[model samples]
Target: MVHAFDFTAPDSYILNCSTLLTELPVLERAQAAKDAGFDQVEFWWPFDGNPTPTSAEVDEFITSLENAGVELKGLNFWAGNMAGGDRGMVSVIGAEDDFAANVAIVVEIGRRTGCRAFNALYGLRTEGQDPSGQDSTAAANLDLAARAVAEIDGTVLVEPVSGAEGYPLKRYADAAEVVAKVRSEGPANIAVLADFFHMSVNGDDVAAVIEVEAANFGHIQIADAEGRGAPGTGSLPLRDWIDRAYALGYTGQVALEYKQDRATAFDWLSHVTQTA
Candidate 1:
């Protein structure tokens, strides 16, 4: 019941600025999150259409973060056509080169900003490709990312996503196994991204997963299960569950990656400020 955590804790709660500021352009999300009273922000690939954006675009992105005065806590490598239903591209057979191309840019963004956490979405199953082959591709790409980010002492996050995207990494163990596989091949920077909303949607024992996977967890994301909305807008006991994660040794940022009307998204900001 006592979910009181230090608000000043390093990487306390990160606002997934991309999810929160849906109405705004990618460049404006950071400012929106800052206006909402969040000091740290994370995002999916800012350029959803381009795996390798131009140098000017990358500089603009860095400047946005700088001007918004928000620390970039997390960033996802280029997940192919995420808005078009592709959960990830790292495992796609033909996407290996593109995924590789995006690595240096992702690392540079992290390097220029102080972001140390990166999320890699395991690509969805292709109709004709064998599952085993796809798994191999994912492992290889994840390994590459792990090695690159390790230069900056960064962590690579693997998360289980939900919905009808037919994504192979839909369970906590599924993601953990991939993280382990990547770590086996490279540095130990690979870890599971424990998004309770996805676990709950997949019917995993959330509490048990937290207890067992806390040590391997690199980052945490949250949303209420009923509609993938803000913490107070759904059925999940987010306050208690998040406290449990912190108690069990999860020191990373608890990213608010959810869907809600931006106009009222900060309604629970006061509660988070008080309780977290």
Candidate 2:
């Protein structure tokens, strides 16, 4: 309940620079958020193609946030070929080494920018690989990520990605189970990245999810169910759900992960940020 009133205001949450300013250059999106009146930002892995990016690239990425005068709030550990159809690789049969390689890099980024939550997307099912095998791989990789993130006083996030065919963790229980399994193996900082839009699309009672799983959520993201637009553009009672989440004991950054068409005018932010 630390940020309970934040449900009524914009400053309390971080803008998802990656998703918000997709039309802008990746390195320049942080500045875009800052220019748009946001003081904090989050992103998917900045490097889409390179998991083990060069140190120079890492420095530039960190510098982007620093230069933009925005605090880095959350980041995803690389999920493979996001544009080429891969949702993630941590749970894939032969991608363990690649996933492992990105752990330190992600942790190092977190250390540099003081970001504390790192999302680990569960990969899609293989054509012939057994379900159990993918599950096992996901658990092990999540455990590994938990250990690394814990070193920096960070949390490893498991998210339920929606509209993703064949991907695991499509439900709140699915992601929660992964977090529980990781915790059972003894890592305490592993938690779910509760994304209301995805949960809504998957036909869950999102408010009930907050009521039941609030304590286990490390972060939250929001977008309307209809067309995944800004809050008022669709039917979601966003303010109510946000308030519900705060009341239920979820104290974490609420990221704006909604999509935009060519024109990215975020007028809703001003309305939300206002106080009487």
Estimate the TM-score of every prediction.
Answer: 0.93, 0.94
**Cα lDDT listed for each candidate:** 0.84, 0.84
TM-score for candidate 1, residues paired by index: 0.93
Q: Candidate 2: minimum summed lDDT over ten consecutive residues — where?
A: 267-276
Question: Candidate 1 — worst ten consecutive residues by lDDT sum?
Answer: 267-276
Candidate 1 ranges with C-alpha deviation above 4 Å:
1-12, 271-276
Which parts of model 2 are misplaced by more than 4 Å? 6-9, 271-276
